[model samples]
Target: MTDIEKKEQYAPYISISRDEWKTLNGALNFSLSDEDISKLNALNEPLNLAEIQEVYFPLSHLLNIHIDFAKKLYEAENGYLNSGRKRSPFIIGIAGSVAAGKSTTARVLQKVLSLWPEKPRVALVTTDGFLYPNKVLEQRSIMNRKGFPESYDTKRLINFLADVKAGKEHLEVPIYSHLEYDIIPNRVQEIHNPDVVIVEGINVLQVNLSEKHQGPQVFVSDFFDYSIYVHANEKNLLEWYISRFKQLQRTAFQNPSSYFHRYATLSEQEAIAIAANIWDLINKPNLIKNILPTRFRANLILEKGSHHFVKGVKLRKV
Candidate 1:
């Protein structure tokens, strides 16, 4: 049987093929301009008008319903607490393997959600900000495992989410610079009172951490109102990662101050070889050991086909 025929195999997720999903896009009046699409798409990722019409518009519509429901829930809870309070930001987590297009999904969701009829204020916070500084990683002897769960200051990340979920205003979040590939010391990105916040990272869907002896085990996932996992077939992800590495060589790596500057002068084949090795040795292992294992935890799964087109989406039945 085909995947569609075997939909029952993946319980709790009603599998919807691209064509089936597109059928739900009834007269949704949303179109992003070429410039906007260019800004939102990741390097070597395909995101055009067709994707917005068929995939994202319906996705955004569903989010609008969820956001509205969340608002009402918050109001009821506040009444029970006997404290007059505004609704906290509806936090959404986006996760997937490296180069699986989570960043693009996060950015696109942030933009699309903000444009809804409610015109809510939306914030996008990447967990990259919570990664331990380079010095700290080196001290921990985990520099080679930069993107692993151990590489993050999970406490700080959890604290930030807690604050955001508490409706705290003018909070500070650490800033990460991809060009430098490190956390900038004393630099923070301020989040004001946003109605919705999208938390994007590879590990967002993973369970929270705590010592067994600790009291209550609070996980990062506890703060999420909804979560998305953007995944591609393993083969497609490897190819996309290599393609991104080559593009970075032509672009970002050319900057002398770039963390990957040494790769700028490499021949195309040479760059691909190094990128492939990195994928095989570092990224693939982490994906298998950490990221992919957490996929089932996501409320929504966007499964992409070759060249980054979302071919299917699995929405959790519950």
Candidate 2:
């Protein structure tokens, strides 16, 4: 079936009301701890914690259940069929448009999931690492399309995920700098065997698993035990993007070596214009063509309201 058709057929195995979602932790009376609240407060942009509780708590509970089931399945299959081999890390993919707060979501999830005794070593890797170097993109004359899928080194990303999921003892992922908007040379992040690995990006569940691709050929998400798509209205997302851009103009964009340094002193109106132009020209198109189209492929969908609170969650039927 086509991806869209498959999404149309999706039904939730467990339906939760907004209130029920917040109380998923039984008598523990689910509440964000002071540390978590502090961390959320430290975010560059605003986030609604109550909304997160209502939306992500139930999702986390569902993920914990899935993790247990996967572990059981792995033990049964490996013990009986393959004579006992250790299963690799549980993988989760988080995808959303730019400024959709997906990075925050991923970080919060890494923190919350790690709190679970069974999954202590949660690791998060962003697909930014897979982006092609700016010099290469400039040479190819696609610098303006940097965040688009074609600008990423998909094969290398796939291989890295493959090795990590295969339980390779140590794996190194290339590092990319947001300030420079390019791959940092000779810099790598070491990932040991993590209980959970969360991969976040604009196109994690992109539904591009055609047969022609092979040799470490599994899509980045083929390794996912669970997947989430953070959803918000296009208008709100655009505004958030503009706001973030203005903030960056004062911060990272002010550095002489930063790629966007030229815009550091732009007037508020001019900065907004530039941000809007970039969003309209590049980000919006990529979202429409690549990112938003895959929302339904996610195992869970966190739908955010105008106030930026997760209003509900749609869980796919098993």
What lDDT tens digits, residue by residue, belong to model 2 across residues 41-157? Answer: 423556556655655565677788888899898998887896656688889999999988898888878877776646468889999999999888999999999888879998888
Candidate 2, pairs of clashing residues = none
State the TM-score for model 2: 0.89
List the global CA lDDT of all models: 0.89, 0.81
Best by lDDT: 1
Write down the lDDT that model 2 would get. 0.81
For model 1, the run of ten residues with the poorest summed lDDT: 208-217
Candidate 2 stretches greater than 4 Å from native = 1-17, 27-35, 40-44, 209-217
Q: Give the clash count for model 1.
A: 0
lDDT string, candidate 1, 130-187, tens digits? 9999999999899999999889998899999999988798888899999999999889
